[model samples]
Target: MDEKRLIEQKIFNDTSTYNDIMNVPYHQSKRHLPMNQLDRAFQFAPFGALEGFNDLIQEKTELYERKKYTTSETELTIERQLKYLQAHSLKVDVNYFNDESGYYEHFKGYLKSLDWKKGRADFDELSVAILNIRSIKLIKK
Candidate 1:
């Protein structure tokens, strides 16, 4: 036979060699156990690097939609309330806009002092900028 035919005949007719390779058993670990269903499932699980991304998006969305307390009517009302508090030295609750975070925060205590010239108000221990004031209300008496 020619060289090509002889090589093909030798390779294709090696059925015993293929049979031996197929019958060989896979190697098993001595100490390590085979993966269970849960462990095997984890191997194919998807991975993400940006954790808490959903929460961050939700926080930003809420911040963007938040209402401001700066309308002219609201400003006038708060100014009147502030004057009343200062004149009476009233114990009041105050909700003021926090410019740094663009949100409202509250303080309920005695009105210690008012500095209209400086545009600031002093509570029991806290000094707040008057321009930041949103609402003021007399508490009990």
Candidate 2:
């Protein structure tokens, strides 16, 4: 019989002999040799390669989707600040218009017509102060 066929027949027919052959140090060493080299090569690759691949994929998806900031927290914050500034400016305008002696009564009428629900308490207080000053000025007039 050929050597290879003899070994194959031994492996199939003799369990103890097959186990001894498999347990040999030379065969054991060969099993781990390639695996150790593969592990070392993977460890030596650049640290950011995997991370860069993920980032590149994310950027491409964002471009494909045309990602936007419509619902972003910062955008909402900026919109709220703009509304507050508009309300605050209205309060300041009412105060400035009320400061002129002749326009006091007209300013009081305008203040009464404003929607205070959308404005801050600071704006409300400034508006009230303007109305009060107008009242005083009317009394003096």
Candidate 3:
């Protein structure tokens, strides 16, 4: 046989070296109980070395993906629609820019009230700031 096979044969033939310990039982700790598979798995689990880094990256990505808005382009259209809708309650779909998330949010609900002095638009469920409104379309019943 080749060198590898010869070595394996020799080792297999000579089992006396490990024979003393071959039948020895495994040792167990008395003070601590054995961990379950899941508990043991968590011992080798990966951890976040840099806390809040993911949140920072997400905030940065949202800022880059934000849609740019100009008052000149949409102000006149939104104002006219607002004036028309102010007279009566109506179901409307509104797309407005969210300053907190730097994104546009779509809201569909019944318009309840509008405050010109405070610059706020109240819906049945929630209220949105007037200046942040991008487009407002009345839902025809």
Candidate 4:
């Protein structure tokens, strides 16, 4: 009677149109195994497009959490300890702020040299600015 009814009768109610396909049985391969729903879902799941991006983000967040403001007293104490360690050539554990990354880094090594004029402390493994030093202690053997 109406356009909607006409289209529905011609398409949906047309049993002969789908009868041939409906009667056909599903085909299963003899060699290949069927995939489970979980495995099939994983095939279309989203993945990380940029490698190492997660690690970089995690490192940044950890740095932010570890960063702290240093006081003048703390700097003065570290400087004093550095001078003593340099004079005695003692093995030490040091914590210093890295300006580039805005995080504190630890070093456990002998103090190789200290330049008061240049304001830097040279360790067996690395050199750090004196002003950036947060704390320093002798590594007891």
Among these predicted structures, which one has the highest lDDT?
Answer: 3
Model 2 has an lDDT value of: 0.42
Write one digit per residue (lDDT tens) for candidate 2, span 1-141.
Answer: 899999999888877756757866754565554567767887788774676788877766655352232335544543454345544443223222232232333232222223345432233334433122211111121
The whole-model lDDT of each prediction reads 0.78, 0.42, 0.82, 0.81
Judge candidate 1 against the unseen true structure and give its global Cα lDDT, from 0 to 1.
0.78
lDDT digits (tens) for residues 1-141 of candidate 1: 899998998898868767768878998999999989997887776664456888888876676465454788877887788777767766788888665566788888988777889988888877888777877877895
User: Candidate 3 or 4, higher lDDT?
Assistant: 3
Better of 1 and 3 by lDDT: 3
**Which regions of candidate 1 are displaced past 4 Å?**
1-69, 100-102
Backbone clashes in model 2, listed as residue pairs: none
Query: Which lDDT value does model 3 have at 64?
Result: 46
| Order of quality (lDDT) | 3, 4, 1, 2
lDDT of 2 at 47: 75
Tell me how many residue pairs clash in candidate 3: 0
Residues 1-141 of candidate 3 have per-residue lDDT tens digits of 899999998988888899899999999999989999997887776674566889989887776477666577587888778878778777889998776777899899877888989999888787888888888887888
Residue 60 of model 3, lDDT score: 74
